[model samples]
Target: MCEAVEKDLYAVLGASPSDSVQQLKYRYQKLALECHPDRLGDVCDSEAESGRRKFLEIDAAWKILSQELQQAWPIDSIVSLEDMTWDHDECVYTYCCRCGGQFIFSEEELPWRQGNDDEKKRNESQHMVVCCDTCSLSIYVKLSFV
Candidate 1:
């Protein structure tokens, strides 16, 4: 996977990582309104472009930060791949969530599922973060290809 250069989303919105979601939302809204392209009326072309770019960055930052915040609840559990139930029909491994939802992992989604035996050995002890499909709860799953 190609990783894009990561910008500090918190810094982009003049926020600290410790800020509450509400605070982040407030900061994002304030910055977004101030730099919105349409709000930057009658500015020179360069200034307009800069405003647009800033607005885009702020918008992107909010999107990522909001999702992370929503999923930031304490991890419900730490489970190993062997603890999950496998469904041959669906080709997925599932673990029941406290909310009656399920945390699903597919074979294709496993990094160690690909590559050579050496690569798989290196990834024998890997981790995957999965969220409950119907709730905010998440779990850390220890993965093994053995």
Candidate 2:
């Protein structure tokens, strides 16, 4: 049995986070064709198994990327604090995004946000973290409620 794990699906598909939906689909298709086991009619059994695994990974990545869409408290780029890599400089908290963009959440934007950590945790939380200005990718920062 195969269990799904949390992974950087974009990396699996050889795609950047900001790639358009069309671009992502294209990449998935290309990888899918390349990795298809049938493409290797005379390969060894092990190689065929490897190709099947590769195809599954590519297909799953596309499914995840296509489902989600979304942004900020002056976050400059929309994203969640948790999904980001934290960096503290002076009074600012900088979050390094997955798409290689930075979302700046300063103390100034704190007031605009909901509440404290406890309250935020008890309730649901989502933030649109922007990936990069060059492309249209946003990090979906979501905390699921239990």
Candidate 3:
């Protein structure tokens, strides 16, 4: 089975992780319509097979992206890494939540934190989900290493 982490869902959908859910949906739908096997009527065998594969890929991408969207939809806000305050003592980044709570971001949660030195050197940006310590609200923290 293909793991979600093994495949770049955003790349499959020709999207960026920073893209809004609505943007992702639009891109997915456009790609799906273009690659759908039914739209390849009367094509050669190879062409039809290729279309089927592309359609399946688009479908899988949508399924995964949609699931992620659903999971992140409840976030109270999106916070940029620079906007968060870093605590040298606690060694964690924090953002103030509206409910008098704090959204804590740790280094361990970073996507590129586990790889080799070369991997760590290649700058990339992505979002991490963090929940308020004192409330039900969560925030999407944008982490960048540019």
Candidate 4:
């Protein structure tokens, strides 16, 4: 796993995070429509590569922010207790992966609070806390099953 990209959601869509979900959706839709690979004309090798990369990033950003999507287990899938490890020194529960992101908590912090109903209803919403060791970017994923 890679670290969280830490992209400002606003910057990704060229709109503010405070923007309504409708606004974000519209912005993403417009970018996707305008930048579709099919619309890019034949071009030099470098230019084509750049266009392809941008299109892929845009599609990924949209998927990350889209209302219809939900978080799945990380590839390699942490499905059981044995899959996780405790970092006694850090006092955090860290996953073994390329990114090294940890669930920052003491035993006191166990049973992290889940998101509220409204947050779930609004797909634009996110969990309150998480961080990426790779980018030092904070994010929230709906966690479950270990």
Candidate 5:
């Protein structure tokens, strides 16, 4: 797809920035089915070229939209301390937001919460659960106590 066309991926998918992922997916699927090359049923039809082109554009829009959705909402990924992704990185812990978002718990927060020192310093910390800012969902995370 051309760079100019890429800029309006949301518009191409019939989506607005405010639309939820589910809404965007639904719209994209509907448009995709409508423009699918095979949906024309006749390869020799005069509009076949146009329909094929439309399908390509729709497919490209979906690909771009899907990637954005995934990044914005990583969801509940259960990462362990051993993953090495979090090693000395800065943040204390990370957790999923019910709204398909993620929030990080900082190292600065560990000392402020009331907890058993031994538990905090052990191989694992208690599961600290919190609600998602975007929705009425809960997020759970554990600190690497070891």
Candidate 6:
């Protein structure tokens, strides 16, 4: 099923479509705090409920905007051709290719994060240790599927 995209968040947050995720997040947080319900109550009793609703709206908008921003200005992901290797017999591979300390997988058929300890251990073992070949230092990697 197709999900409905929210078109009004830009106007609600007073942000341009091109605004970076960080920019959107900062703007939303600032606006949410400025229009907090409790703060609004002191100014106008009738506007308190309205302010609360807007706050919720902004929170929702922030969630979507942040995701979009991350996609646009993704953390540096660099893979070096020389450092990647494959173990065809085990259907496993390891890489020293990444510039930043992160790993990403493109296999859509595999189930990644859901499993028991034995499965976890098995998967961990399959992963070839990836590290900075230049520094020979291991960097922390964040995993995500696209």
How many residue pairs clash (N, CA or C atoms closer than 3 angstroms) in each of the candidate models, in the order given? 0, 6, 0, 0, 0, 1
Q: How many backbone clashes does candidate 5 have?
A: 0
Write one digit per residue (lDDT tens) for candidate 5, span 24-137: 666787898889988888677669998998889889888887776656643454444344234266754545554575455444344323234564344443444333446544
TM-score of 6: 0.44
Off by over 4 Å in 1: 1-71, 113-125
Once superposed on the true structure, which residue ranges of model 5 sit more than 4 Å away at CA?
Answer: 1-6, 43-46, 76-146
Worst 10 residues of 2 by lDDT: 69-78
Estimate candidate 1's alpha-carbon lDDT, on a 0 to 1 scale.
Answer: 0.80
Candidate 3 per-residue lDDT, tens place, 1-146, comes to: 97666778899899997565545666787798889888888999999998899889889988988886667547898888899998999998889988898877566445455344364333543666676777667787776665
Cα distance off (Å), candidate 1, residue 10: 17
Q: How many Å off is the CA of 144 in candidate 2? A: 42
**C-alpha lDDT (0 to 100) for residue 48 of candidate 3:** 94
Write down the lDDT that model 4 would get. 0.50
lDDT of 2 by residue, 21-88 (tens): 44566578778888987887898989989989989989888887777632211224334455545455
lDDT, each prediction: 0.80, 0.58, 0.75, 0.50, 0.59, 0.52
Q: Once superposed on the true structure, which residue ranges of model 6 sit more than 4 Å away at CA?
A: 1-6, 43-45, 77-146
Show the colliding residue pairs in model 1.
Answer: none
| Model 3 CA deviation exceeding 4 Å by range | 1-5, 75-146
The 10-residue segment of model 6 with minimum total lDDT is 105-114
Could you tell me which 10 consecutive residues in candidate 1 have the lowest summed lDDT? 112-121
Cα RMSD to the true fold for all candidates: 13.0, 15.4, 11.3, 14.3, 15.6, 14.4
- lDDT measured at residue 77 in model 6 versus the true structure, 0 to 100: 38
Candidate 6 per-residue lDDT over residues 1-146, each given as its tens digit: 99987567788899987543434655786798887776775656567777888888888888877665544443333443234454565454345434543332222212332233355544543322123333333323333222
Order candidates by lDDT, high to low.
1, 3, 5, 2, 6, 4
lDDT of 1 by residue, 26-97 (tens): 688789888999898899999999999999999999999988776685589999989999999999989999
On the 0 to 100 scale, the lDDT of residue 67 in model 3 is: 89
Of the two candidates 5 and 6, the one with more favorable TM-score, higher being better, is 5
TM-score of predicted structure 5: 0.48
- Model 4 earns a TM-score of 0.41
